[model samples]
Target: MPPTPPSTPARDEARIRDRGDACPGALRLHAADDGGLARLRLPAGRLTAHQVEALAVAAETLGDGRISLTSRGNAELRGLAEECGAELAALLAEAGLLPSPTHERVRNIVASPAAGLDGLGGPEVQLWARELDALLCAEPWAAALSGRFLFVLDDGRADVAGLGGDVTLVAVRPGAGQEPAARQESAAGQDPTAGRLHVGGRAWLVAGADAPRAALAAAGAFLDAARAAGNGAWRVRELPEGSTPDVAGALDRAGIAAEPVPPAESLLVHAPPLAPGPLGTASFHVLAPLGRLTAAQLRALLPAEEVRLTPWRGAVVVGAAPGHQDHARLAALDSHGLITRPDSPWAGVSACTGRPGCAKSRADVRADAAPGSARGLPVHYSGCERRCGHPHGTWVDVVATADGAYLVDGAPTPRTALPDAVTTARTGAIARAATPSTPAETTR
Candidate 1:
């Protein structure tokens, strides 16, 4: 079983931000120890084959020769020259990846990657994401949103509902005699065309056609609550205690009829990520090792009509031929070093940019974590205590220490023992044994 998560911090202990977030976007590049880093948000993680090729070209010519996948289903180009910001922006814009300059940073959105292609789940929520992105860009007020604020759209499969989102919209599964429509309420008082909109701890039933606008309204409500509280909260979870956003009121003002759902009945269903493999007959899911893809690996996914990056640090290649042909494609991806099987050791393994790239890092954690063995739980290797790009929920936490050693789940271990120690921690053997005593500090 996954270990229980720690309790939420007290209101007084919550983070208080006095300045805006400095998250990098296509228009805004962040200067790191390695070089300039540009984050391009792919709402719903949708990318055309041409867009993929364009990113490959950008990475090879302007920045690092590799692309890094963020936990939020976004892409990052590192090792860029400071003067290439304008050029990078132009490249992305030409590829249609940068639609709105003002709303670039705030375009953080993730949806069920296998929605319509998988033959499971309800109404395709990817379409909903596109509509929401358009609505967000058109609204000038949305530019005020922090770059980290996220909107999650689940296709009733519960794939993305668990990902922490400021605003979440989940399609409601239709009954035997029902069909999805627009703004139509059934005789039983249920809206067949409605979805469950969750903001903070509250949830409401909203029409499918109105869901995109309702999601934006929810964000606006959060902004209002944050302003009233003067907490400068960037996410809904960061709002002051007891100051939940007035989502219902916001919906009412927008002329969107919303039905309040009781807290007990509004609990979201959590589902594991879509494992790497073929999904039904239309899509092939594959993972990038350590969430980094070489230019060659990126091109290996070509001939795909569309690619949807998943929040799990993988992608769903859509419009693939079924059966033998899809299997052949998966094999090709495997040849190029992508994780095409769930049993691959690289599965559930992630690491933050360490070593020369991040000045704060004490060691090259990624280099050390590359030989990791497969285990039951996910394992994340962090260069420092900040634990950037860590996975959500319970997992093995490996942090590099000042003494040039590692702390596997807080148990100090030497560098030479990392492999065995990490495997033990990930397999739950460390949790079952008596805690080890703190050892004397030692250099690697």
Candidate 2:
């Protein structure tokens, strides 16, 4: 393991100002270089087989035949025409993808990718997830939440909780020491009856409520405090003056049961390339080469086994047949360069369409940072300062500037020679220089 770096003083923490996050959604689209971009938030990253099929149809009918998975466990429709927004929204609504137009953007929820896989925490987590979703939709005021605010319902395994959710509902084993389901107790003892429900890595006690109701109340309380802050902050952590919701207090007020506990380590669901599930599977996960699926390829996936879009930048097709042309389906995707191995360079590398696609781009960064340019590390290719679509986990950042590019590993480095610098990066060679001004000067 890399040596744990010394704790660095917070520098950028105070630099951010509170403003409504301009996170795009299906109803509110962003105009990008390619065209219009529509982000469909999939709470818990869970979608029924029907919803997945509808997404595919929406991708084909309304926007470009391509779909991009987001770090937030959401789906994005790219290259959409302006006129198609309303029509696409209606289609999504019909497909049950959009339950509430008013509360659409606030529905950012993510759960364990393998919640039910191998019988981890299937019924309980799924039940809790549904309860939380229903509660969120029922609250009329939840629409005020920024699209970026996130909620995580973990099965005490910490898979999704570790992704930096503002509010979390973790279900521990029933027999574990839990806090008494009541408020007004002193905050001293670890409530043995209430399993921990952590927020921002800090645990809190829920006094009278179960997991589902406690989570819903916790979210509501966070929103209430966020709005009271009156600074346009969307997430609980973003509230100024430490004004975020108090998990324990909120649970107390809501009459839910909870108690504080240390943050649990979350596991990344890193499934390797595997065979497609049984045929006629309802929900399906598909892996796209470079996350770019062609029109024809997508068409073939139609009438698919169901789909659960994953944050790992892959698609999960549930309910497919055990041997449903597994080799052929994966082979076809491989032909398109979408390999599912974690060792593949493309597995972690991401790039924003630079130059021709984006007007703000100063260089064709994507062309320079192609698959050949990848060096067995998570490197992002950005055209300018706004590094769109960067990786979420630990990664090697190769951000381009006008003069050259800036290389950021654990420590920052400057590379004047772009191509050679890439090669040096692959070899773990550290090249340092004063930050360059031009793109070429930044190369190796």
lDDT of 2 at 320: 40
lDDT (C-alpha) at residue 147 in model 1: 88
> What are the per-residue Cα lDDT tens digits for candidate 1 across 34-146?
89988999999999999999999999999889988887899989999989988988899999999999999999999999888767875458889999999999999999999
Q: Report the C-alpha lDDT of model 2 over 373-410, residue by residue, as the tens digit.
A: 44444555666655666544344456666665544432
- The C-alpha TM-scores of every prediction are 0.91, 0.76
Q: lDDT: which candidate is best? A: 1
TM-score of candidate 2 relative to the true fold: 0.76
Q: Look at candidate 1 and give me any clashing residue pairs.
A: none
Clashes of each: 0, 67
Candidate 2 residue-pair clash tally: 67
